[model samples]
Target: MQPSGILETALYVTDVEAAAQFYGGLLGLEVILRAGDESVFFRCGSGVLILFNANKLKDRPKGGLPIPSHGATGPGHVCFSATRDEIASWKSHLEVHGVAIESEFDWPNGAHSLYFRDPSGNSIEFAEPKLWNLQ
Candidate 1:
């Protein structure tokens, strides 16, 4: 058997609070959980987005099974699926909140996407669902 779908995606951020404000406040994602200053979790349509404090997790003691503590330094990326109409609305909403739109792409298949950075500089994208389907 093979994996059916992605359940969660994570990004390393320096400040959990600022990440929360950007994901929850600006994007309207629901803050599902917060692990003190270490991490924050947001519910994103059928999946979970985890914002982790890289510095904090880097020093945590290892537990059984040798599970690696995941963290990153440079910008991470996560893309969310939206409808064409929703993509347009998102552009307007982001502008209203003063979030800069870094760039936008129109795929040859006619799908479009908007790219922007979060508080910790993780590249976030919202693209039309059709962008991911096999042409």
Candidate 2:
């Protein structure tokens, strides 16, 4: 059997509050939940974006649900689907907010993509669905 699709995407950050500001305040994602300074969850389209402070995982409160500890160190990458128009808008919005655009280009398939880094240095991308031949 094959899994249907992704339901969550996780990105490790140094500070939940700063990450929250970037994802929530800048990107306009809806804040769904917050777990003290350890983690924060945001609703992104049909999926959830989870930001976790890896440094605090070892000290997380014990014995509630026995969830396995999970996190990644160093920089990670994540991409959001965007239309051409939306990408253009995003470029302007990001520049206005002082979020440097690391790279922006057209793929061989003619799809467009833009990249940037979050506060924690995680690579963030916005690309046209056509980049993957998606409709």
Candidate 3:
């Protein structure tokens, strides 16, 4: 059987507070949990977005849970679903918050996408669901 959907998405950041400010304060994602300086969890619709401190998790002691050690370097990417109106609004909102829009364009399918970066330099995007022919 195939997995239904993603429950969580993660991105590694150098600083957790900066991530919290960007994702929670700027993007308006509700802060669900905070794990000291290691990670921050945000509620993004039905799913969760987690930002982990890249340096902190590198030597994490695996004692309590079966979760394995994981980390990533450089910039990662995540795209959120948004309609045309919402995408346009997001462009203005982000700019007012000093977030520079890296690119804004239409795909071959005519779906519009707006791209920016998070505090950790991870590529963030807002695109129409039709980008993948989804509703």
Candidate 4:
């Protein structure tokens, strides 16, 4: 059997509250849950964005199901889908919030994207739907 689709994505951050402000307050994502000061969860379309304290996750109890403990120090990346017009609007919105635009890319398939960083230095991208089209 093949995999269906992504259900969740995560980014390790130093500050959970700051991450919540950036993803929830600035980006307008719905905050689904928060695990005290450990992590914060946001609803993004059909998937979820999880921002957790890397150092804390490293110490999480490894239990029954043999779940792997994952954490990273530096930056992580996640891309969100948007329309061409939405990309433009997002660029402006990010700038107004003092988030710098790192770059913009024009793919051969006509899809475009804007790249930037979150408060924790995680690389974030907003690209048109055609970004993953194989044709």
Candidate 5:
């Protein structure tokens, strides 16, 4: 295999299925591969993203995955694009689900974006790009 950039980001989540639901169902990503209780690999663009059991990977973080912590979520966020309607849909979905909204920022490009945390408290950004063109 040839060398390349980060092909995956594997998070140790409390609930893998929930992560899949939010990232796959809500975010509209197709599930690429899901293995038993071990881990799941997702097809994202030209690469893959993964989620492993934090408890299982605590002892050993395979494939350069982040080391599991007692409660630390580290830093930064994961971003996803949305269809115009989807972006509007998320505001309601998150509120109905009881997830706290962190902040919503407007980019100079006219992109409309919102930030929120997942069940595992990982930062996630949902964005609609057409707003950028408007800007």
Candidate 6:
């Protein structure tokens, strides 16, 4: 298996620009790619956040927002790893935005994590994984 690792996470949003502002302005992500009225990609460490124009999908005759089928099947969450200090800051940042904290944990090695969701209800987290490989 070629575990090259995940490259990005695509999430649906009502407003792409607003999502960018929340993620980029407040969360310190950098917009790496943006095609007006289509999609915008934000950089978070080695990963990317892909946000699409919600209305554009609606304007199309064939495709609307993607929903789970008969049961939860495919994509679920997009986690961003952060340093210990960064995790603390992220916890406060999300709190200030009135974002609900779904959970928090202190790992065995003392690394920490906080889970929450975006405006579109996609579950996301800022974590400090104790065992991450550079390779």
> What is the C-alpha local distance difference test score of each model?
0.89, 0.94, 0.94, 0.91, 0.71, 0.72
lDDT of 3 by residue, 17-67 (tens): 999999999899999999999999998989999999999988787698889
Top-scoring candidate (lDDT): 3
lDDT of 6 at 69: 23
Worst 10 residues of 5 by lDDT: 67-76
Which candidate would rank higher by lDDT, 1 or 5? 1
Whose TM-score is higher: candidate 3's or candidate 4's? 3
Query: After best superposition, candidate 4 residue 37: deviation in angstroms?
Result: 1.3
Alpha-carbon shift of residue 35 in model 6 (angstroms):
2.4
The Cα error of candidate 5 at residue 26, in Å, is 3.4
Q: What C-alpha lDDT does candidate 4 achieve relative to the native structure?
A: 0.91
Per-residue accuracy of model 6 over 70-134 as CA lDDT, tens digit each: 21222247778787788788888888988789998886766677888776566787777663542
Candidate 2, 1-135: lDDT as tens digits: 998878999999998999999999999999999998989999999999999997888677878897887878789999999999999999999999999999999999999999999999999999999998888
Higher-lDDT candidate of 2 and 3:
3
Off by over 4 Å in 1: 64-66
Off by over 4 Å in 2: none
Alpha carbon deviation, residue 115, candidate 6 (Å): 1.1
lDDT of 2 at 104: 97
Ten consecutive residues with minimal summed lDDT in candidate 6? 67-76
Residue 120 lDDT in candidate 3: 85
Spell out the clash pairs found in candidate 1.
none
Clashes of each: 0, 0, 0, 0, 4, 0
Per-candidate TM equals: 0.92, 0.95, 0.97, 0.92, 0.64, 0.70
Worst 10 residues of 1 by lDDT: 62-71
Off by over 4 Å in 5: 1-6, 61-76, 83-85, 128-135
Per-residue alpha-carbon lDDT of candidate 4 for residues 52-85, written as tens digits (9 for 90 to 100): 9887887787685686777777899999999989
